[model samples]
Target: MRRRFGQSLRVGVAPGALALLKTSRWGGAAPELVGELAFEGGSHPEAIGVALRQLLQGGGCANWPVSIVLADELVRIWQVAPPAGSARLADLEAAAALRFQTLFGEPTGAWKLSAGWDPAQPFLAAALPRNLLALIEQVCAAQRAPIVELVPQFVAGFNQWRAALKAGAWYGLVQQRVLTLGMIDGGAIRAVRATALPEGADLDWLAAHVAREALRLNLAAPARVAVSGHAPAAWSKGATHAPLACHLLGQGQGAGWSDCARLAATGSRP
Candidate 1:
C-alpha cells in the first residue's frame, strides 16, 4: 500500500544544479519555487548530496515526500517494442535489462531499471546507476526526507507538455546539455530520441539536430516547437524552411522549470 502525504517536494536534478519546488495538491495547482542550488564541477553524488542537505536545511522541506527528476546525463532512456503477450513484470524487466546492456555496453545488473508500457506504442524504460540511487537515498534519509519517486527529466517535461502537444505533431526539448525530440500522434508517442549537446554548442546546432532526427524518424515538420532554457528564436532560423513556430515552455508567469517540478510532484508517469 502507498502512504498518503499532505505536502510534496519536487526536485529537478540537473548536471550541476538543483531546482526545488513545493506543492500541496499534486496536479491541482502550480508548484511554488522553494529555491535552486548550484554546485561546482560535474554531477557527482557527493557534491549533489551535500547541496541537497543544505537545501533541505534551509528550505523547510525535510518532512515532505520528495520526487526527483533526473537530468538526461544521469538517466538512460530507451524506447523498445512492447512485449508480445501477457509477459510478467520480471520477464519484461529482464528483457529491458538485456537491451540496455546491448545498447550501452554496461552491465545492467548494477543499474536500477523502471519500465513504462503503453499498449498502443513502444514501451519506454529508464535506467539509473544504483550507486547514484544509494547516494540520494542516504542523503534523503539523513535529512528525514522520504523519496516517493524518481523520474527522467524528459518524462517530467513530457507530462507537463502533454496537454499542449497536438496529434501528429513533433516536439523538441533542449535543456542541460541535452536535446530530446519526439513525435506524438493520437495522444501517444510514436518516436523519440535524446542526444547530448557538445560543449558550447549553439541553438542553431540544436535546431539542425532536431530537424535531422525528425526526418530520420519520418516525421513531418513540427506544427510548433516548444522550448525551454533558451529563447525559441535560437532554434527558429536553423530549423529547415521558414522560421519554425515555437512556444516557449514557460510562456507566462505560472510556467517554467517549475512546471516540470509540478508534474513530478503530481506523480505523472511516462
Candidate 2:
C-alpha cells in the first residue's frame, strides 16, 4: 500500500515575482524542476524549458496539489506561447488535477494560491474560474488552514530553502511579504494578515513597514524577519525588534521551510 504522508514544496520563479507551492500527501519523490515552473523563465522560457525537460527525464511522480502566483504580464505572455506541452496559468487547475490523479490516484487537498509583487502593488487579482475553485476547494479540505497567508515571497523563500537543503547547505531564507500580526500557538503561525508590498522598495523598507503595521494593528512584534531575493544586511538593527535573518536561497534548509509543514498541518483548509 502507498504510504499516507504529506509534503509541501514552494517554488519561487526568476525574472518575475511569483511564489508558488505544491503540498501533497503521497510519498513519491518530488519533481526535480528547480523553483516554481510557472514563470516564462525571465527572457528565456525556452532555455528553462530545456532544463526542465532534462530534469523530468529522470522520471519522478507528479501527484501533488499545486498553487502558483506570478506577475500578470508573465501569464499573458505564456498564454500565447504554443510551445509543445506548455501550460498557461489559466490551465493550472486542470493540470494540477491531472498531475494528482496520474501520481496519487486522487487529488490531495486545497491549494492556497497567493502572489507577491516585485514592487509591492495595491491590488492583486485572483482569477480562478468557478470550476477551478471547486477543484482547489476539494483538495484543500484534507489540509490545514493557512495560519500565515501563503504569499508569493514566503513561497519563494520556501523554494529557495528546499533547493538549498537538497544541495546540502545552511543558509538564511528571505520572504518579502506584508506582515500582519498573527497568533502563534506553540510556535506555529496562525491568524495572520496578508497583503502585497509597495513599488521600488527593498527588504529594509519592508521590515520597517511591517513593524509599523504591527503596531497599528495592535499586534505584537514579529518573532523574527527573514528575507530572500535581496540582502538581509539592509534590515534595521534595533533592540526590541524581531531578529532579522536574510540569505539567498540556494542551499541548506532555512527557518521558514523548517516550520512551514507544521504551519500547513495546523491550518489545513478545504
Candidate 3:
C-alpha cells in the first residue's frame, strides 16, 4: 500500500539552492514542504552533493520515490538537426554531440546527452554532467529512494503544458532568474537557449529579446511567446501592440503546478 503522506518527493536543484516538496500521488491536497536549502557557488556537483546529503539524512524522506528537477542552467540544452531523412539513432547522437560541443565549447566525454530523436526535423538535446547525474542517483539510492525522473525544468514544463501552449508561438520557461527559450516551427525545435534575466525586465524586454533572437537566427519570429513558469504581472497587461504577446501558461503562483516546477512556482524560501 502507498504511504498516507509524502508518497513522492520532488526535488528542484538550481545553481545555488535546492527545494524539496513531498507530494501524495493519491490525494488532491497540496504538496507538503519537506525543506529548502541554499548555498554559495555555482551549480557544481559538490554543492549539490552536500545539499542532497543533508536533505536525505532527515530520515523522513527515506524510501519515498524521488523526482529530480534540474534547472535549465544546470543542463546544457540545444537544438539538433538530424540531417534530413537520416534518422539512424547513431547519426542523431553524433550530430547532437557535435552541436553540443560547438555551442558550449565543451567536450562530451564528461556529460551524458539525451535528445528527442527525429529524422524529419530538428529536435532538442540536453546534456548533464556525468558526475552530477551519478551523484544524485547514488545519494538517493543510499537512502533507499527510487528515482522516477531526472529532468530539466524546461522539458518538464513543456511536457506538462504542451496542449495549453499556443501552436506556433515560441516557448519559454522562466524560473530562478533564467529564461529558457525554445524556438519551434513546423512541429520541430529550431533552437533552445537559456538566458539569464536582467532586473526590471518586462514585456517590452521580452518582445525585444525574442525579436532579436529571431533576427540573429534568421528565422521568422513567432507572433507570441508561450511561457510556462512564473511570468511577471507586467507580461500580461498592455502589450497588445507589442510585436510579440506573452502568453502565460500554467499558474503564476499557488498549489497548482507541475510536480517538477512546484518549488519554483511557489517561490519557496530556505
Estimated TM-score per prediction?
0.74, 0.30, 0.87
- lDDT by residue (1-270, candidate 2, tens digit) is 121356544333234222333445454443222332333445344543343333222223144333333222222110111223444544544443444345436443433333221121111212222333343333333332222232333333344343333221222223343332222222332223444555644555655655665567465545454433323343434524343332333322222442222222221211
Ranking by TM-score: 3, 1, 2
- Candidate 2: stretches off by over 4 Å: 1-31, 34-130, 133-191, 228-270
Q: Model 1, residue 230: what's the lDDT?
A: 32
Scored by lDDT, model 1 comes in at 0.66
In candidate 1, position 110 carries an lDDT of 73
Model 1 per-residue lDDT at 16: 68
CA displacement after TM-score superposition, residue 132 of candidate 2 (Å): 0.5
Model 1, residue 252: what's the lDDT? 37
Q: In each prediction, how many residue pairs overlap at the backbone (N, C-alpha, C within less than 3 A)?
A: 0, 21, 0
Candidate 3 regions with alpha-carbon error over 4 angstroms = 254-270
lDDT of 1 by residue, 1-270 (tens): 122466677787766677777766554555667788877756787887788778777776666788887877788878766567735776677667777888899878778888775543567788887877888888889878899878776777676666776555556666645567666655556666766777655555555665676677776655556654433444544545453555556433234554334333333321
CA lDDT of each candidate?
0.66, 0.34, 0.76
TM-score of candidate 1 against the unseen true structure: 0.74
